[model samples]
Target: MKILQRKRKRIAAVLFTLTLMLCSCGQHAKTEQKHDWKAEAETASVYCVGKDDCFLCGTDAGYFGQNNIGIVSLNSFAVMPVEINRYDHNGQLIEENTGAMQMENFQNGENGMTVSVMLEPDRGIAHISISPNGDATLDLASAASHLCCDCLAELVSQLYGSVNGIGVVNFSTRRLYVLQEGVTSFGAGDYYVHCDYEALGGEIKILVIYSSLRYENLK
Candidate 1:
């Protein structure tokens, strides 16, 4: 009788676990089904083309005493192009693949800055500031824009080192706004608790600025 009872309890526990798994899967599927990925991709493509060009400033100089600038844009699939041209003072261009992690649906912020997004500049963009120096701020209000949280964190981690750089991430906490249609939103907090990826529907935005400390190398 004791053995039979133990077996029954084990079976019940397994059934409960299976039920939970099924329910979680069903919820995830429902969320994905409700989102319109095709529409989002189309809208993002149009916005990428129509939006003003943004710039990324690196810490070192590829020109004469000036930080190299990266022109940023989103492609049809919402991925940023890896090949960026660094233009010299005379307008001569040198192409280099920066090997920077690509982001999705990223756009220019105030003053056409690639990494910073100002939803309402006057009121100040809502953000969870991460770095103590106030260089890394995670935008908390952008709905349609998205990037990879891990990529943003990787950039942020680089900031604390000897490297001359800054980073930012933009994400939404709104329950309804899914960053990437079918992608899960809960794991975004692995980077920074305050800059919760779920806050941006599992999407992150980044802003990195490199100082011009290496300008002498170009000369």
Candidate 2:
């Protein structure tokens, strides 16, 4: 009877150890899922592809306030030149006059890097900023153009899943409430698009926030 009792106790101990191990693994997985997307972006190679015409100050393109700046991963290399000039002399540099995002600029918290991309000599826009925490901000130009939608889609494509399969949709005047003039937000699958009208400055800002576990299955 004593031998049988000892065997039962050993079996119970083994089961308890297995349960603890399983719980620990589950918790570790949950933690990884929470930050997987950020890890990918933090490690991936990013490039700032800006137009040559608009890169320098006082160009003809700058006079018209037309510039297309692409902040993307190496996978989405396009026609634009990767080399960029200093746009925001006032903002803190990750390195002196680097004019590009660096590894040190990538972080998971409030102190994420923000830089300005000049449209012209006199006017500059804080157009794009990104963090290691899988979050980014694109301050769209005040002009209510379809290009803003394209820019958002382009950025999203590089960060999360491919937007190629996703249907093309425009940010209509009705949706942005351009006439109404206030902050409004709407959902787009795993992302949130926010439209804000700065009454004081008379400027329209479109902020896109990525909100989903799109990288939970990243291998």
Candidate 3:
């Protein structure tokens, strides 16, 4: 009799497990992957890529503000150019410069970068600046002068730029928004088509890790 009762209990448990698994599917909630802010700031790499081809898990990244100063973790970051200036300087090395998003490969116009620590939570943390170059200046000549960031998921890999993908985590909103530039994808041949970020200062997107959209208020 006891053996029969045990068999019945096992079957009941299996049914419950199956039910839970079925219920868990089809949920589209954005969850933040917790990390130490200090650790991220300590080993951060600032970079950029043509916002054209870069995409998310199959979804077109869509265009962002002209100033795409986005961020992603080291492990998640894609390997792009090491630096911008080759002869006069060495790889975005402007003395105090920590690093850059060398977007020349993906940009169509005057490629420029602006640096900032405004994303920091408070004044106490603001002074702990990430880039040694004291918030690199924006490409004044370029058309775009703001910042946008993106991070990709398993849906589909970006056409170009950093493979890790860039995204943001908003604790207050309990939401995480991934950064993507446009709906279309750009290829090697396309690089020269719109190439003019240097002279025209068009849409420039940087991979950043900001906490809020307050950057929209940047002067």
Candidate 4:
């Protein structure tokens, strides 16, 4: 009887986990269909185009010097050419592909400067703050629009695979944390968390900033 009880308990636990994943996925699907992705992408693009261009600042920027600008990366190496674009300082399209990345909102704040930008392929826009000391955090204004369902679930799993709503995830050794609140981190080895979690119509969206130049596989 004890063995039977143990098996039942295990089964129950599995069922519960499956239930949560199903619920989350269902809610996310509904959320995606409700939002206009193209509109979201355009809006994100327009906002950043008006701001300053600085790619070097987002990923773990403290190691950089005054003469050194920063680097940008994709979530994965499977970069398709059409996914990137180049813009002149005048905001003129130097060259563009189906997907484009634009950096903006490079300014000084009490903690650090707010880094705002957009990534194509996914076309999510994130507004994040970094301290002069290289600490990373995101605010309410930070958002990830135009995200896809698969990417959403994958990103969620990266944060310890918790289904209890999208929340803080720490890969401290990698010096990476994502989708959290009031962060005070020292460093990490990789870009683990790629988005800030924003709840919309029962679904979650992630807004992210890179603390290092490494392109994370948010998908």
Point to the candidate with the largest TM-score.
2
| Per-residue lDDT over 127-158 for candidate 3, one digit per residue giving the tens place of the 0 to 100 score | 11122121122121110111113332211222
Error of 2 at 19 (Å): 1.8
Worst 10 residues of 4 by lDDT: 74-83
Measured by lDDT, the strongest candidate is: 4
Ranking by lDDT: 4, 2, 1, 3
lDDT for position 162 in model 4 = 23
Off by over 4 Å in 1: 2-10, 26-35, 41-88, 93-219
What would the per-residue lDDT of candidate 4 be over residues 31-126, giving only the tens digit for each residue?
Answer: 744644344344444323111222221333232221111211112101011112234455454433545455444433343322333454233223
TM-score of each: 0.25, 0.26, 0.21, 0.20
lDDT of 1 at 3: 100
For model 1, name the residue pairs that clash. 59-210, 59-211, 170-205, 171-200, 172-199, 172-200, 173-199
What candidate 2 gets wrong by more than 4 Å, as runs, is: 51-219
Candidate numbers sorted by TM-score from highest down: 2, 1, 3, 4
The C-alpha local distance difference test score for the whole of candidate 2 amounts to 0.31
Candidate 1 lDDT over 1-219, as tens digits, reads: 999999999999999999999999999888755554344434443322111221112222223232222212211112122112244458555445444443322334322223322222122122221111221222221211332332222222322212111222221111111222122222221122123333233234322232224346655
Model 2 clash tally? 0
